[model samples]
Target: MKNIISTIAFLFITINLISQENNQMKLGDKIGEFSALDDQGNVWKSTSAKSDFLVVYFYPAAMTGGCTKQACAYRDDKASFDELGVTVIGISGDEVKNLKYFKDSYQLNFPLLSDNEGTISKIFGVPANKGGEITREIDGENFLLVRSITTPRWTFILNKERKVIYKNAEVNAVEDSKNVKEIIKNYSK
Candidate 1:
């Protein structure tokens, strides 16, 4: 029994290590293929959206202070982003319904994707939210459920070839769009 347990532990450890190593997303690396449900309840494949540049960002949650600020900043600069032919997509672990509400409420023009499973977040190496729970009452019965984890505040700028040209692990919410513009300007030269 002891040997069997030890072998199981070793296998688990090895698998965890391999997953961690595969989750590293760095500059110059093309994003892994992912399909996510967007705010409109449409399945969007990352490869389907091609442009001169693509900005894939992960935020903690929908309708939150920091996340709202970051999203609106991008919305307000739509013209500038459009001028540069950059497509911005924001990802969060929020459900598709919540994402739609947030987008409609904020008048967000870009795509907001649901990452409730944390698969996309893991692939990007962004830390997922640790704890949260929700209690739902349906018709008279009450049920407690753990909330989906959110992703870290990070952004990636990819070039035409879909290779990451710039990555910001710690993004400044309000100033992130401007910073990305600066990087794009420098990068285009």
Candidate 2:
């Protein structure tokens, strides 16, 4: 009985490790190709994002504190990114309308894609919550509303060759663009 239990435990551990390995994207790995809807309702195909490099960031939600900080950081550094010939794309599971509001409110210079089904998050190995709904109060009345899946803070810098040159599973919200800039500068050389 003890031997059988040990075998079962080993199987469980091995399965868990395999699952995580399947989801992770390591350095030098090519990013999986994807096409999704941006905030403006236009299709963005990975093949068509003509640029020297692409900065793909996955954030938890729109209008939230850390997400906003990260978005604004990208926005504030737009000129520098443009100078480097890099294009930034932010992805979240929020509704398209909410993402639009977030962009307009923050004056974000880049496109924010709505990944409502968590497809992009899964492809990028970002942790995402399963879809659900929640009740919220608005002017003293409770209303049921859909909740966007939450994604862990993550960023991937893909070169023109579509290979991931740099990846950060744990991102610092305030210093995100600077970090990306430094990485780009070093990697470009």
Which number leads on TM-score?
A: 2
User: Can you write out model 2's per-residue Cα lDDT over 14-98, one digit (the tens) per residue?
Assistant: 9966776698888898886898888888888888778899999998777778888999999999999998989999998877766
* Pairs with steric clashes in candidate 1: none
RMSD of each: 4.5, 4.1
lDDT score of model 2? 0.84
Compared with the true structure, all predictions reach lDDT values of 0.84, 0.84
Model 1 spans > 4 angstroms off: 1-22, 131-147
| Residue 85, candidate 1: C-alpha displacement in angstroms | 1.2
- Compute the lDDT of residue 137 as modeled in candidate 2: 46
- Candidate 1 global CA lDDT score: 0.84
